[model samples]
Target: MKAIVFGSTGFIGSHTVEQLILKGHKVTAVVRSHSNVAFLQSLDVRIVEIDYSDTASIKEEIEGHEVVYNCIGSVGLRSKIDLENAVEIDLTKKLVRAASLSGANRFIQLSSIVVYDFHSSEPLDESYCIKPQYLIQQLLLKREEVVRKIGEETGITTIILRPASAIGRRDYMSFFSRLFQQHMNDQFPLLKNGETKVSLVDTRDVGRAMEWLGNYPFPKGSMNLFLLKGFDTTWKSLKEEIDYERGIEVTICDLSNIVEDPVSYTLNTFRTHRVWNDEKIRKLGFTTKYSQRESVKDAVQDFRDRERI
Candidate 1:
Protein backbone atom coordinates (compact mmCIF):
# COMPACT_ATOMS: atom_id res chain seq x y z
CA MET A 1 0.00 0.00 0.00
CA LYS A 2 1.19 3.48 -0.84
CA ALA A 3 0.42 5.89 2.01
CA ILE A 4 0.89 9.64 2.28
CA VAL A 5 0.90 11.63 5.51
CA PHE A 6 0.69 15.39 5.98
CA GLY A 7 2.77 16.96 8.75
CA SER A 8 4.71 13.70 8.70
CA THR A 9 7.56 15.10 10.81
CA GLY A 10 5.32 16.21 13.65
CA PHE A 11 4.94 14.35 16.96
CA ILE A 12 2.14 11.96 15.90
CA GLY A 13 2.82 12.18 12.16
CA SER A 14 6.44 11.04 12.46
CA HIS A 15 5.41 8.07 14.59
CA THR A 16 2.66 7.16 12.14
CA VAL A 17 5.06 7.33 9.20
CA GLU A 18 7.52 5.02 10.93
CA GLN A 19 4.79 2.48 11.68
CA LEU A 20 3.59 2.53 8.08
CA ILE A 21 7.08 1.91 6.72
CA LEU A 22 7.72 -0.90 9.25
CA LYS A 23 4.53 -2.58 8.03
CA GLY A 24 6.06 -2.68 4.49
CA HIS A 25 3.95 0.14 3.09
CA LYS A 26 5.88 2.73 1.10
CA VAL A 27 5.25 6.01 2.96
CA THR A 28 5.45 9.54 1.57
CA ALA A 29 6.00 12.10 4.31
CA VAL A 30 5.11 15.75 3.69
CA VAL A 31 7.55 18.37 4.93
CA ARG A 32 7.81 22.13 4.60
CA SER A 33 11.58 22.71 4.87
CA HIS A 34 15.03 21.46 5.83
CA SER A 35 14.25 20.99 9.54
CA ASN A 36 11.24 18.86 8.61
CA VAL A 37 13.50 16.93 6.21
CA ALA A 38 15.90 15.81 8.96
CA PHE A 39 13.16 14.38 11.18
CA LEU A 40 11.44 12.45 8.33
CA GLN A 41 14.87 11.21 7.23
CA SER A 42 15.41 9.78 10.72
CA LEU A 43 12.24 7.76 10.05
CA ASP A 44 13.55 6.87 6.54
CA VAL A 45 10.26 7.95 4.98
CA ARG A 46 9.94 9.24 1.40
CA ILE A 47 9.71 13.02 1.54
CA VAL A 48 7.32 15.36 -0.32
CA GLU A 49 7.82 19.04 0.36
CA ILE A 50 4.76 21.33 0.27
CA ASP A 51 3.15 24.02 2.37
CA TYR A 52 0.45 22.37 4.51
CA SER A 53 -1.61 25.57 4.40
CA ASP A 54 -1.65 25.68 0.60
CA THR A 55 -4.38 23.83 -1.33
CA ALA A 56 -3.12 23.77 -4.96
CA SER A 57 0.35 22.72 -3.89
CA ILE A 58 -0.98 20.01 -1.57
CA LYS A 59 -3.28 18.68 -4.31
CA GLU A 60 -0.33 18.40 -6.68
CA GLU A 61 1.83 16.75 -4.00
CA ILE A 62 -0.88 14.42 -2.68
CA GLU A 63 -1.60 12.65 -5.99
CA GLY A 64 -0.98 8.92 -6.67
CA HIS A 65 -1.26 7.87 -3.00
CA GLU A 66 -3.69 5.16 -1.96
CA VAL A 67 -4.45 6.79 1.36
CA VAL A 68 -3.81 10.19 2.97
CA TYR A 69 -3.67 10.77 6.70
CA ASN A 70 -4.37 14.27 7.95
CA CYS A 71 -2.17 14.27 11.06
CA ILE A 72 -1.43 17.99 10.67
CA GLY A 73 -2.18 20.08 13.76
CA SER A 74 -0.96 23.02 15.80
CA VAL A 75 1.40 21.91 18.56
CA GLY A 76 0.19 24.23 21.31
CA LEU A 77 -2.31 26.89 22.31
CA ARG A 78 -2.03 30.48 21.16
CA SER A 79 -3.76 33.83 21.48
CA LYS A 80 -4.44 34.29 17.76
CA ILE A 81 -5.02 32.09 14.69
CA ASP A 82 -2.64 33.88 12.29
CA LEU A 83 0.35 33.48 14.66
CA GLU A 84 0.09 29.80 13.72
CA ASN A 85 -2.38 28.12 11.34
CA ALA A 86 -3.83 26.49 14.49
CA VAL A 87 -7.34 27.65 13.81
CA GLU A 88 -9.45 24.91 12.20
CA ILE A 89 -11.21 26.97 9.58
CA ASP A 90 -7.92 28.09 8.04
CA LEU A 91 -5.79 25.02 8.82
CA THR A 92 -8.19 22.09 8.38
CA LYS A 93 -9.82 23.57 5.31
CA LYS A 94 -6.56 23.42 3.43
CA LEU A 95 -6.01 19.72 4.20
CA VAL A 96 -9.57 18.70 3.45
CA ARG A 97 -9.61 20.59 0.16
CA ALA A 98 -6.38 18.98 -0.93
CA ALA A 99 -7.58 15.48 -0.10
CA SER A 100 -10.84 16.06 -1.92
CA LEU A 101 -9.04 17.26 -5.04
CA SER A 102 -6.45 14.50 -4.88
CA GLY A 103 -9.20 11.88 -5.20
CA ALA A 104 -7.55 9.50 -2.74
CA ASN A 105 -9.32 6.24 -1.99
CA ARG A 106 -9.08 6.59 1.78
CA PHE A 107 -8.78 9.75 3.84
CA ILE A 108 -7.93 9.23 7.47
CA GLN A 109 -8.31 12.49 9.38
CA LEU A 110 -6.55 12.45 12.75
CA SER A 111 -8.80 14.60 14.90
CA SER A 112 -9.26 15.40 18.60
CA ILE A 113 -11.61 13.96 21.23
CA VAL A 114 -12.03 17.51 22.52
CA VAL A 115 -14.54 18.17 19.69
CA TYR A 116 -17.31 17.03 22.01
CA ASP A 117 -18.14 19.54 24.69
CA PHE A 118 -17.01 17.89 27.95
CA HIS A 119 -20.22 18.19 29.93
CA SER A 120 -21.54 14.65 29.92
CA SER A 121 -21.98 12.68 33.11
CA GLU A 122 -21.65 9.53 31.02
CA PRO A 123 -18.86 8.83 28.55
CA LEU A 124 -18.77 11.10 25.45
CA ASP A 125 -19.70 9.41 22.14
CA GLU A 126 -19.80 10.32 18.43
CA SER A 127 -23.42 11.38 18.55
CA TYR A 128 -22.71 13.92 21.24
CA CYS A 129 -22.63 17.47 19.85
CA ILE A 130 -21.87 19.47 22.97
CA LYS A 131 -19.33 21.34 20.78
CA PRO A 132 -15.89 22.68 21.70
CA GLN A 133 -15.56 25.26 24.44
CA TYR A 134 -12.07 26.59 23.83
CA LEU A 135 -10.69 27.93 20.54
CA ILE A 136 -8.79 24.86 19.36
CA GLN A 137 -11.59 22.47 20.19
CA GLN A 138 -14.10 24.56 18.30
CA LEU A 139 -11.92 24.51 15.20
CA LEU A 140 -11.62 20.69 15.30
CA LEU A 141 -15.40 20.27 15.41
CA LYS A 142 -15.79 22.38 12.25
CA ARG A 143 -13.03 20.44 10.50
CA GLU A 144 -14.68 17.10 11.32
CA GLU A 145 -17.96 18.26 9.81
CA VAL A 146 -16.29 19.45 6.61
CA VAL A 147 -14.40 16.18 6.19
CA ARG A 148 -17.59 14.20 6.58
CA LYS A 149 -19.28 16.29 3.92
CA ILE A 150 -16.47 15.79 1.42
CA GLY A 151 -16.55 12.02 1.99
CA GLU A 152 -20.28 11.88 1.46
CA GLU A 153 -20.31 13.93 -1.72
CA THR A 154 -17.16 12.61 -3.37
CA GLY A 155 -17.18 8.95 -2.25
CA ILE A 156 -13.93 9.36 -0.36
CA THR A 157 -13.60 6.62 2.26
CA THR A 158 -12.99 9.03 5.12
CA ILE A 159 -12.11 7.68 8.55
CA ILE A 160 -11.63 10.04 11.46
CA LEU A 161 -9.52 8.98 14.46
CA ARG A 162 -9.87 11.00 17.62
CA PRO A 163 -7.16 9.84 19.97
CA ALA A 164 -7.32 11.06 23.56
CA SER A 165 -4.01 12.63 24.63
CA ALA A 166 -1.48 10.74 22.45
CA ILE A 167 1.48 9.56 24.50
CA GLY A 168 5.04 8.61 23.52
CA ARG A 169 8.39 10.28 22.89
CA ARG A 170 8.61 12.77 20.01
CA ASP A 171 10.58 15.85 18.97
CA TYR A 172 8.06 18.05 20.83
CA MET A 173 5.63 17.58 23.73
CA SER A 174 1.88 18.23 23.60
CA PHE A 175 0.11 21.00 25.49
CA PHE A 176 -0.62 18.73 28.43
CA SER A 177 2.71 16.93 28.16
CA ARG A 178 4.52 20.26 28.51
CA LEU A 179 2.42 21.04 31.54
CA PHE A 180 3.27 17.62 32.95
CA GLN A 181 6.93 18.41 32.32
CA GLN A 182 6.47 21.69 34.16
CA HIS A 183 4.92 19.79 37.07
CA MET A 184 7.90 17.45 37.13
CA ASN A 185 10.41 20.33 37.10
CA ASP A 186 8.57 22.45 39.67
CA GLN A 187 8.13 24.90 36.81
CA PHE A 188 4.32 24.79 36.84
CA PRO A 189 3.55 27.32 39.51
CA LEU A 190 -0.02 27.89 40.73
CA LEU A 191 -1.26 24.32 40.96
CA LYS A 192 -4.90 25.02 41.65
CA ASN A 193 -7.32 22.17 42.46
CA GLY A 194 -5.25 19.49 40.76
CA GLU A 195 -8.16 17.07 40.91
CA THR A 196 -8.98 17.29 37.20
CA LYS A 197 -8.75 13.83 35.59
CA VAL A 198 -6.93 13.18 32.29
CA SER A 199 -7.47 10.36 29.80
CA LEU A 200 -4.43 9.30 27.76
CA VAL A 201 -3.80 7.04 24.74
CA ASP A 202 -0.33 5.83 23.84
CA THR A 203 1.02 7.00 20.48
CA ARG A 204 1.74 3.35 19.73
CA ASP A 205 -1.95 2.72 20.05
CA VAL A 206 -2.59 5.59 17.63
CA GLY A 207 -0.20 4.02 15.17
CA ARG A 208 -1.94 0.67 15.49
CA ALA A 209 -5.31 2.28 14.88
CA MET A 210 -4.01 3.86 11.68
CA GLU A 211 -2.55 0.53 10.53
CA TRP A 212 -5.80 -1.27 11.29
CA LEU A 213 -7.77 1.18 9.17
CA GLY A 214 -5.30 0.89 6.31
CA ASN A 215 -5.74 -2.91 6.16
CA TYR A 216 -9.50 -2.97 6.59
CA PRO A 217 -11.65 -1.55 3.82
CA PHE A 218 -14.14 0.99 5.07
CA PRO A 219 -17.68 1.61 3.79
CA LYS A 220 -18.10 4.62 1.51
CA GLY A 221 -18.67 7.37 4.09
CA SER A 222 -17.28 8.75 7.34
CA MET A 223 -16.65 7.05 10.71
CA ASN A 224 -15.61 8.45 14.06
CA LEU A 225 -12.68 6.55 15.57
CA PHE A 226 -11.97 7.13 19.26
CA LEU A 227 -10.52 5.45 22.36
CA LEU A 228 -12.70 6.19 25.33
CA LYS A 229 -10.59 7.53 28.19
CA GLY A 230 -12.12 5.11 30.70
CA PHE A 231 -9.15 5.40 32.99
CA ASP A 232 -8.48 8.78 34.58
CA THR A 233 -5.49 10.17 36.53
CA THR A 234 -4.84 13.32 38.46
CA TRP A 235 -1.85 15.68 38.44
CA LYS A 236 -1.29 14.94 42.13
CA SER A 237 -0.75 11.25 41.29
CA LEU A 238 1.63 12.22 38.53
CA LYS A 239 3.53 14.37 41.02
CA GLU A 240 3.61 11.47 43.49
CA GLU A 241 5.15 9.18 40.88
CA ILE A 242 7.78 11.77 39.99
CA ASP A 243 8.55 12.36 43.67
CA TYR A 244 8.99 8.62 44.20
CA GLU A 245 11.46 8.49 41.33
CA ARG A 246 13.42 11.65 42.23
CA GLY A 247 13.15 11.31 46.07
CA ILE A 248 12.21 14.97 46.28
CA GLU A 249 8.77 16.48 46.25
CA VAL A 250 8.83 18.89 43.34
CA THR A 251 7.73 22.37 44.25
CA ILE A 252 4.14 23.07 43.20
CA CYS A 253 3.46 26.79 43.16
CA ASP A 254 0.57 27.81 45.38
CA LEU A 255 -2.76 27.91 43.56
CA SER A 256 -4.27 30.62 45.70
CA ASN A 257 -1.60 33.13 44.76
CA ILE A 258 -2.69 34.38 41.30
CA VAL A 259 -0.73 35.92 38.46
CA GLU A 260 -1.02 36.95 34.77
CA ASP A 261 -0.39 33.46 33.40
CA PRO A 262 -3.34 31.91 35.24
CA VAL A 263 -4.47 29.80 32.24
CA SER A 264 -1.21 27.86 32.18
CA TYR A 265 -1.83 26.39 35.60
CA THR A 266 -5.27 27.06 37.05
CA LEU A 267 -7.64 27.10 34.06
CA ASN A 268 -6.04 24.45 31.82
CA THR A 269 -5.52 21.93 34.60
CA PHE A 270 -9.06 22.50 35.82
CA ARG A 271 -10.56 21.73 32.36
CA THR A 272 -8.57 18.52 31.71
CA HIS A 273 -10.81 16.48 34.03
CA ARG A 274 -13.17 15.30 31.26
CA VAL A 275 -13.03 11.60 30.21
CA TRP A 276 -13.11 10.18 26.63
CA ASN A 277 -15.10 7.14 25.48
CA ASP A 278 -13.12 4.66 23.33
CA GLU A 279 -15.62 1.83 22.91
CA LYS A 280 -16.10 2.68 19.23
CA ILE A 281 -12.43 2.14 18.55
CA ARG A 282 -12.28 -1.16 20.50
CA LYS A 283 -15.25 -2.44 18.51
CA LEU A 284 -13.09 -1.92 15.41
CA GLY A 285 -10.23 -4.21 16.66
CA PHE A 286 -7.85 -1.70 18.27
CA THR A 287 -6.50 -2.39 21.78
CA THR A 288 -4.36 -0.10 23.91
CA LYS A 289 -1.01 -1.74 24.70
CA TYR A 290 -0.33 0.52 27.66
CA SER A 291 -2.76 0.95 30.53
CA GLN A 292 -3.23 4.48 31.85
CA ARG A 293 -0.78 3.96 34.74
CA GLU A 294 1.76 2.20 32.54
CA SER A 295 1.65 4.79 29.75
CA VAL A 296 1.86 7.74 32.12
CA LYS A 297 4.66 6.14 34.09
CA ASP A 298 6.56 5.42 30.90
CA ALA A 299 5.99 8.97 29.65
CA VAL A 300 7.23 10.44 32.93
CA GLN A 301 10.22 8.13 32.77
CA ASP A 302 11.03 9.27 29.24
CA PHE A 303 11.03 12.86 30.43
CA ARG A 304 13.58 12.03 33.14
CA ASP A 305 15.72 9.79 30.91
CA ARG A 306 15.88 12.52 28.28
CA GLU A 307 16.44 15.01 31.12
CA ARG A 308 13.55 17.02 29.69
CA ILE A 309 12.55 17.86 33.27
Candidate 2:
Protein backbone atom coordinates (compact mmCIF):
# COMPACT_ATOMS: atom_id res chain seq x y z
CA MET A 1 0.00 0.00 0.00
CA LYS A 2 1.15 3.54 -0.71
CA ALA A 3 0.49 6.28 1.85
CA ILE A 4 1.00 10.04 2.16
CA VAL A 5 1.76 11.61 5.53
CA PHE A 6 1.63 15.33 6.38
CA GLY A 7 3.63 16.73 9.27
CA SER A 8 5.87 13.77 8.60
CA THR A 9 8.69 15.31 10.60
CA GLY A 10 6.63 15.96 13.70
CA PHE A 11 6.58 13.85 16.84
CA ILE A 12 3.53 11.77 15.90
CA GLY A 13 4.08 11.97 12.18
CA SER A 14 7.64 10.65 12.36
CA HIS A 15 6.50 7.64 14.34
CA THR A 16 3.67 7.02 11.89
CA VAL A 17 6.12 7.02 9.01
CA GLU A 18 8.36 4.55 10.79
CA GLN A 19 5.46 2.21 11.50
CA LEU A 20 4.22 2.43 7.94
CA ILE A 21 7.62 1.43 6.56
CA LEU A 22 8.04 -1.40 9.07
CA LYS A 23 4.64 -2.75 7.99
CA GLY A 24 6.06 -2.91 4.42
CA HIS A 25 3.94 -0.06 3.09
CA LYS A 26 5.53 2.55 0.81
CA VAL A 27 5.36 6.11 2.16
CA THR A 28 5.57 9.62 0.74
CA ALA A 29 6.28 12.15 3.49
CA VAL A 30 5.06 15.71 2.89
CA VAL A 31 6.44 18.42 5.12
CA ARG A 32 7.29 22.10 5.10
CA SER A 33 10.66 23.15 3.70
CA HIS A 34 11.74 24.17 7.18
CA SER A 35 11.24 20.64 8.58
CA ASN A 36 14.30 18.47 8.77
CA VAL A 37 14.29 16.01 5.84
CA ALA A 38 17.35 14.08 6.99
CA PHE A 39 15.34 12.02 9.41
CA LEU A 40 12.78 10.99 6.80
CA GLN A 41 15.61 10.13 4.41
CA SER A 42 17.20 7.99 7.12
CA LEU A 43 14.09 5.80 7.02
CA ASP A 44 14.42 5.15 3.27
CA VAL A 45 11.09 6.93 2.56
CA ARG A 46 10.32 9.24 -0.33
CA ILE A 47 9.86 12.88 0.71
CA VAL A 48 7.68 15.58 -0.84
CA GLU A 49 7.74 19.25 -0.01
CA ILE A 50 4.60 21.27 0.83
CA ASP A 51 3.00 23.31 3.56
CA TYR A 52 -0.35 22.13 4.88
CA SER A 53 -1.24 25.69 5.87
CA ASP A 54 -1.59 26.45 2.18
CA THR A 55 -4.42 24.91 0.15
CA ALA A 56 -2.80 24.83 -3.27
CA SER A 57 0.41 23.50 -1.80
CA ILE A 58 -1.33 20.60 -0.05
CA LYS A 59 -3.75 19.84 -2.88
CA GLU A 60 -0.80 19.52 -5.25
CA GLU A 61 1.25 17.14 -3.13
CA ILE A 62 -1.70 14.93 -2.12
CA GLU A 63 -3.10 14.41 -5.62
CA GLY A 64 -2.29 10.71 -6.07
CA HIS A 65 -1.99 9.06 -2.66
CA GLU A 66 -3.88 6.02 -1.41
CA VAL A 67 -4.02 7.32 2.16
CA VAL A 68 -3.65 10.84 3.60
CA TYR A 69 -2.87 11.45 7.25
CA ASN A 70 -3.61 14.87 8.78
CA CYS A 71 -1.54 15.50 11.89
CA ILE A 72 -1.16 19.27 11.70
CA GLY A 73 -2.07 21.35 14.76
CA SER A 74 -0.82 24.06 17.14
CA VAL A 75 -1.16 24.72 20.85
CA GLY A 76 -1.25 28.39 21.82
CA LEU A 77 2.01 29.06 20.02
CA ARG A 78 0.63 31.20 17.23
CA SER A 79 -0.33 34.82 17.10
CA LYS A 80 -3.84 35.70 18.29
CA ILE A 81 -4.67 37.04 14.83
CA ASP A 82 -7.66 35.49 13.09
CA LEU A 83 -5.43 34.32 10.24
CA GLU A 84 -4.16 31.43 12.33
CA ASN A 85 -7.63 29.95 12.61
CA ALA A 86 -8.16 30.56 8.94
CA VAL A 87 -4.96 28.71 8.15
CA GLU A 88 -5.91 25.76 10.34
CA ILE A 89 -9.51 25.37 9.22
CA ASP A 90 -8.67 26.13 5.62
CA LEU A 91 -5.96 23.47 5.44
CA THR A 92 -8.23 20.84 6.95
CA LYS A 93 -11.06 21.71 4.59
CA LYS A 94 -8.68 21.70 1.63
CA LEU A 95 -7.07 18.39 2.60
CA VAL A 96 -10.40 16.66 3.00
CA ARG A 97 -11.44 17.92 -0.39
CA ALA A 98 -8.17 17.00 -2.06
CA ALA A 99 -8.19 13.47 -0.65
CA SER A 100 -11.74 12.80 -1.74
CA LEU A 101 -11.09 14.16 -5.22
CA SER A 102 -7.94 12.04 -5.51
CA GLY A 103 -9.86 8.86 -4.74
CA ALA A 104 -7.82 8.20 -1.64
CA ASN A 105 -8.79 5.08 0.28
CA ARG A 106 -8.75 6.60 3.76
CA PHE A 107 -8.24 9.94 5.52
CA ILE A 108 -6.97 9.70 9.08
CA GLN A 109 -6.96 12.82 11.26
CA LEU A 110 -5.01 13.19 14.50
CA SER A 111 -6.97 15.27 16.99
CA SER A 112 -6.63 16.15 20.65
CA ILE A 113 -8.77 15.01 23.58
CA VAL A 114 -9.52 18.66 24.36
CA VAL A 115 -12.72 18.49 22.29
CA TYR A 116 -14.45 16.86 25.27
CA ASP A 117 -16.09 19.24 27.69
CA PHE A 118 -14.57 19.71 31.12
CA HIS A 119 -17.93 19.79 32.85
CA SER A 120 -18.95 16.27 31.78
CA SER A 121 -17.51 14.83 35.03
CA GLU A 122 -17.76 11.35 33.50
CA PRO A 123 -15.77 9.28 31.07
CA LEU A 124 -16.29 10.61 27.53
CA ASP A 125 -16.98 8.70 24.35
CA GLU A 126 -17.42 9.82 20.74
CA SER A 127 -21.08 10.49 21.52
CA TYR A 128 -20.16 13.08 24.11
CA CYS A 129 -20.70 16.43 22.45
CA ILE A 130 -18.42 19.46 22.86
CA LYS A 131 -19.22 23.14 22.84
CA PRO A 132 -16.17 25.25 22.12
CA GLN A 133 -15.06 27.70 24.80
CA TYR A 134 -11.76 28.49 23.09
CA LEU A 135 -10.85 29.41 19.54
CA ILE A 136 -8.46 26.48 18.93
CA GLN A 137 -10.82 23.88 20.33
CA GLN A 138 -13.59 25.30 18.20
CA LEU A 139 -11.42 24.88 15.10
CA LEU A 140 -10.97 21.14 15.77
CA LEU A 141 -14.69 20.78 16.44
CA LYS A 142 -15.30 22.50 13.11
CA ARG A 143 -12.71 20.37 11.30
CA GLU A 144 -14.45 17.24 12.56
CA GLU A 145 -17.61 18.37 10.83
CA VAL A 146 -15.75 18.89 7.57
CA VAL A 147 -14.08 15.46 7.77
CA ARG A 148 -17.28 13.65 8.68
CA LYS A 149 -19.17 15.33 5.84
CA ILE A 150 -16.50 14.51 3.26
CA GLY A 151 -16.66 10.87 4.29
CA GLU A 152 -20.42 10.79 3.90
CA GLU A 153 -20.48 12.71 0.63
CA THR A 154 -17.56 11.06 -1.18
CA GLY A 155 -17.69 7.57 0.41
CA ILE A 156 -14.07 8.02 1.49
CA THR A 157 -13.05 5.91 4.46
CA THR A 158 -12.33 8.51 7.18
CA ILE A 159 -11.07 8.03 10.70
CA ILE A 160 -10.08 10.38 13.52
CA LEU A 161 -7.87 9.39 16.45
CA ARG A 162 -8.07 11.59 19.55
CA PRO A 163 -4.91 10.73 21.42
CA ALA A 164 -4.35 12.43 24.79
CA SER A 165 -0.94 13.98 25.60
CA ALA A 166 1.27 11.80 23.41
CA ILE A 167 4.92 11.56 24.53
CA GLY A 168 8.10 9.86 23.30
CA ARG A 169 11.52 10.62 21.80
CA ARG A 170 12.10 14.10 20.32
CA ASP A 171 8.81 15.18 21.86
CA TYR A 172 8.00 18.85 22.15
CA MET A 173 8.95 19.97 25.64
CA SER A 174 5.56 19.98 27.35
CA PHE A 175 4.86 20.28 31.05
CA PHE A 176 4.74 16.51 31.18
CA SER A 177 8.09 16.22 29.44
CA ARG A 178 9.47 18.95 31.66
CA LEU A 179 8.29 17.01 34.68
CA PHE A 180 10.15 13.98 33.46
CA GLN A 181 13.28 15.98 32.71
CA GLN A 182 13.23 17.59 36.13
CA HIS A 183 13.13 14.23 37.82
CA MET A 184 16.02 13.12 35.68
CA ASN A 185 18.07 16.15 36.70
CA ASP A 186 16.69 16.03 40.24
CA GLN A 187 15.46 19.56 39.73
CA PHE A 188 11.76 18.87 39.36
CA PRO A 189 9.75 21.40 41.27
CA LEU A 190 6.92 20.27 43.46
CA LEU A 191 4.20 22.06 41.64
CA LYS A 192 0.63 21.71 42.88
CA ASN A 193 -0.52 18.40 44.23
CA GLY A 194 -0.48 16.14 41.16
CA GLU A 195 -3.96 15.07 42.19
CA THR A 196 -5.59 16.25 39.02
CA LYS A 197 -6.81 13.61 36.59
CA VAL A 198 -4.76 13.49 33.39
CA SER A 199 -4.57 11.07 30.47
CA LEU A 200 -1.45 10.02 28.54
CA VAL A 201 -0.60 8.13 25.34
CA ASP A 202 2.77 6.90 24.18
CA THR A 203 3.87 8.33 20.86
CA ARG A 204 4.75 4.80 19.82
CA ASP A 205 1.20 3.56 20.44
CA VAL A 206 -0.13 6.37 18.31
CA GLY A 207 1.85 5.04 15.34
CA ARG A 208 0.77 1.48 16.11
CA ALA A 209 -2.88 2.44 16.41
CA MET A 210 -2.88 4.27 13.09
CA GLU A 211 -1.31 1.30 11.31
CA TRP A 212 -3.84 -1.10 12.87
CA LEU A 213 -6.83 0.99 11.80
CA GLY A 214 -5.68 1.36 8.19
CA ASN A 215 -7.12 -2.08 7.33
CA TYR A 216 -10.70 -1.57 8.53
CA PRO A 217 -12.90 0.07 5.95
CA PHE A 218 -14.94 2.85 7.54
CA PRO A 219 -17.75 3.85 5.26
CA LYS A 220 -19.67 5.30 8.18
CA GLY A 221 -16.54 6.78 9.84
CA SER A 222 -15.06 5.93 13.23
CA MET A 223 -13.08 7.73 15.97
CA ASN A 224 -10.72 5.70 18.11
CA LEU A 225 -8.84 6.25 21.39
CA PHE A 226 -5.08 5.82 21.89
CA LEU A 227 -4.70 6.64 25.55
CA LEU A 228 -1.71 4.85 27.11
CA LYS A 229 -2.05 6.21 30.63
CA GLY A 230 -4.77 6.46 33.25
CA PHE A 231 -7.05 9.31 34.30
CA ASP A 232 -4.68 10.69 36.88
CA THR A 233 -1.06 10.46 38.06
CA THR A 234 -0.97 11.57 41.65
CA TRP A 235 1.80 13.83 42.98
CA LYS A 236 2.77 11.24 45.58
CA SER A 237 3.13 8.51 43.03
CA LEU A 238 5.05 10.77 40.67
CA LYS A 239 7.53 11.74 43.38
CA GLU A 240 7.88 8.21 44.65
CA GLU A 241 8.65 6.91 41.19
CA ILE A 242 11.29 9.56 40.58
CA ASP A 243 13.04 8.66 43.80
CA TYR A 244 12.89 4.95 43.07
CA GLU A 245 13.68 5.10 39.34
CA ARG A 246 16.63 7.47 39.59
CA GLY A 247 17.68 6.83 43.16
CA ILE A 248 17.29 10.47 44.08
CA GLU A 249 15.07 12.55 46.31
CA VAL A 250 12.66 14.72 44.39
CA THR A 251 10.30 17.37 45.74
CA ILE A 252 6.62 17.48 44.85
CA CYS A 253 4.30 20.22 46.01
CA ASP A 254 0.54 20.24 46.25
CA LEU A 255 -0.23 22.89 43.74
CA SER A 256 -3.15 21.03 42.24
CA ASN A 257 -5.09 24.27 42.41
CA ILE A 258 -2.43 26.00 40.32
CA VAL A 259 -4.48 24.78 37.42
CA GLU A 260 -6.80 27.55 38.47
CA ASP A 261 -4.17 29.99 37.14
CA PRO A 262 -1.14 28.39 35.58
CA VAL A 263 2.06 30.26 34.76
CA SER A 264 1.07 29.87 31.15
CA TYR A 265 -2.52 30.14 29.93
CA THR A 266 -2.14 26.94 27.93
CA LEU A 267 -1.37 25.02 31.11
CA ASN A 268 -4.37 26.51 32.85
CA THR A 269 -6.55 25.19 30.08
CA PHE A 270 -5.01 21.72 30.43
CA ARG A 271 -5.51 21.75 34.20
CA THR A 272 -9.10 22.85 33.99
CA HIS A 273 -10.92 22.33 30.71
CA ARG A 274 -9.66 19.16 28.98
CA VAL A 275 -11.18 15.70 29.54
CA TRP A 276 -11.63 12.42 27.57
CA ASN A 277 -13.13 8.93 27.97
CA ASP A 278 -11.20 6.56 25.69
CA GLU A 279 -13.15 3.41 26.55
CA LYS A 280 -15.18 3.55 23.36
CA ILE A 281 -12.08 3.73 21.15
CA ARG A 282 -10.36 1.06 23.22
CA LYS A 283 -13.19 -1.36 22.43
CA LEU A 284 -12.67 -0.64 18.75
CA GLY A 285 -9.23 -2.44 18.67
CA PHE A 286 -6.53 -0.04 20.00
CA THR A 287 -4.48 -0.81 23.09
CA THR A 288 -1.65 1.02 24.91
CA LYS A 289 1.79 -0.42 25.63
CA TYR A 290 2.70 2.11 28.30
CA SER A 291 1.00 3.13 31.52
CA GLN A 292 1.50 6.52 33.17
CA ARG A 293 4.23 5.18 35.42
CA GLU A 294 5.93 3.22 32.68
CA SER A 295 5.72 6.16 30.34
CA VAL A 296 7.11 8.52 32.98
CA LYS A 297 10.10 6.30 33.52
CA ASP A 298 10.81 5.98 29.83
CA ALA A 299 10.27 9.69 29.26
CA VAL A 300 12.68 10.58 32.04
CA GLN A 301 15.33 8.27 30.74
CA ASP A 302 14.96 9.57 27.21
CA PHE A 303 15.47 13.12 28.43
CA ARG A 304 18.49 12.17 30.49
CA ASP A 305 19.99 10.02 27.82
CA ARG A 306 19.69 12.84 25.31
CA GLU A 307 20.64 15.75 27.57
CA ARG A 308 23.25 13.81 29.55
CA ILE A 309 21.56 14.47 32.90
How would you encode candidate 1's per-residue C-alpha lDDT over 1-309 as one tens digit per residue? 888988777777877887898889988988777644655677757787776556788788778887888887753455454423445556566666677678777888888775655456455666576645566666676677778876777777778877777667663658547667676567554354566566767776677678777768667555545544435666566566556655667777565555454354235545446567677767866666766556656666776666753
Candidate 1 Cα errors over 4 Å, as ranges: 52-56, 82-91, 171-173, 187-193, 223-231, 245-247, 254-272, 297-309
Model 2 ranges with Cα > 4 A deviation = 51-57, 77-85, 181-192, 220-232, 256-275
Q: Please provide, for model 2 over 155-180, each residue's C-alpha lDDT reduced to its tens digit, 9 standing for 90 to 100.
A: 77788877777767666655566666
For every candidate, C-alpha RMSD to the true structure in Å: 3.7, 3.6
